[model samples]
Target: MIIGLHVQVTVNRPLGSTHPEHHTIQYPLNYGYVAGVIGGDGEPQDAYVLDVATPVRQQTGYVVAIIHRRDDNETKWVVAPKFRFVTEAEVRKATNFQEKYFQDDIWLL
Candidate 1:
């Protein structure tokens, strides 16, 4: 996904929420799926909402980057405020809770 594209996200996994299968892992940022969009995983396309101050159930933001996983087919979109920006290092830190298990790279718009 290109940056600056406004998109809505439904937060299936909010910040601090434990992973559905792996209870030991916690989501550091709002994590969810794009409505009505299917990804390589055969589910709704997943996205990570960043630059938000507090936890939320759902929101809309612009895409800043894509987290393409080498080990898995599913890729994740990084959403943030239009005026806000997230560095590559910050992106890694924010997603490392679960992403640590995958081989991935960040692609900015």
Candidate 2:
């Protein structure tokens, strides 16, 4: 229920990096998860970090939107700085580097 609040995330996959296991997949942005907040995957909820242009180990930002996957059980949260409102189009473009394989919608808060 942190749909509109700022939360802490541990960046397991930083920007310009590849998945530890799926080496073919590359991360264009800071992709992480909220500790202790379990998702449908039975793990820490995964998130897509936005507005941050550089790689980081962790970050704190507002939960601006939820990327609900129609083809998968996983739902990713969209986090961005509180200073600006991120457009849905921007989210789609930023996450497309990886999310292109799945069907999703941006649920704005």
Candidate 3:
């Protein structure tokens, strides 16, 4: 993903939402999918919105990083404020709730 491109995310799972099947896993950040884009999983590309404090149904933001899953074909886009920055560790921690189930790498642009 480009570092500064404004992306529209359609949030299927908003912040504080629980996993559809894994009810115990709560989302700490807004989790969604890029509108009109299909991913390697043959579904809408998944995305995680960071640094934003409130719950949101949808949002537009710049791409900050890409969460590449080594074991799976799907890749998740990390979206955040244009001027904000998050370290690799921070990204890892934020997405760990679900990402921990897969081998992954965080690529910051």
Q: Enumerate clash totals for all models, in the order shown.
A: 0, 0, 0
> Lowest lDDT 10-mer window, candidate 2?
79-88
Kindly state the number of residue pairs that clash in model 3: 0
Q: lDDT tens digits, residues 29-105, model 3? A: 99999978899999988999988788898888988888889999999999985646779998998899999999988
The whole-model lDDT of each prediction reads: 0.86, 0.88, 0.88
Residue-wise C-alpha lDDT for candidate 1, range 16-92, written one tens digit per residue: 78989999998888999888889989999899988876789898988888899999999999998673667889889
- Judge candidate 1 against the unseen true structure and give its global Cα lDDT, from 0 to 1: 0.86
TM-score of 3: 0.92
lDDT of 2 by residue, 1-109 (tens): 7677778889999998998888999998999999988998898999989888999999998898889999998999989867356788988998888888899888875
Error of 3 at 12 (Å): 1.2
TM-score of each: 0.91, 0.91, 0.92
Worst 10 residues of 1 by lDDT: 79-88
- Which candidate has the top score in TM-score? 3
Two-way lDDT contest, 1 vs 2, winner: 2
Q: Which stretches of candidate 1 lie above 4 Å from their native place?
A: none
Cα deviation at 21, candidate 3, in Å, is 1.2
lDDT of 2 at 32: 96
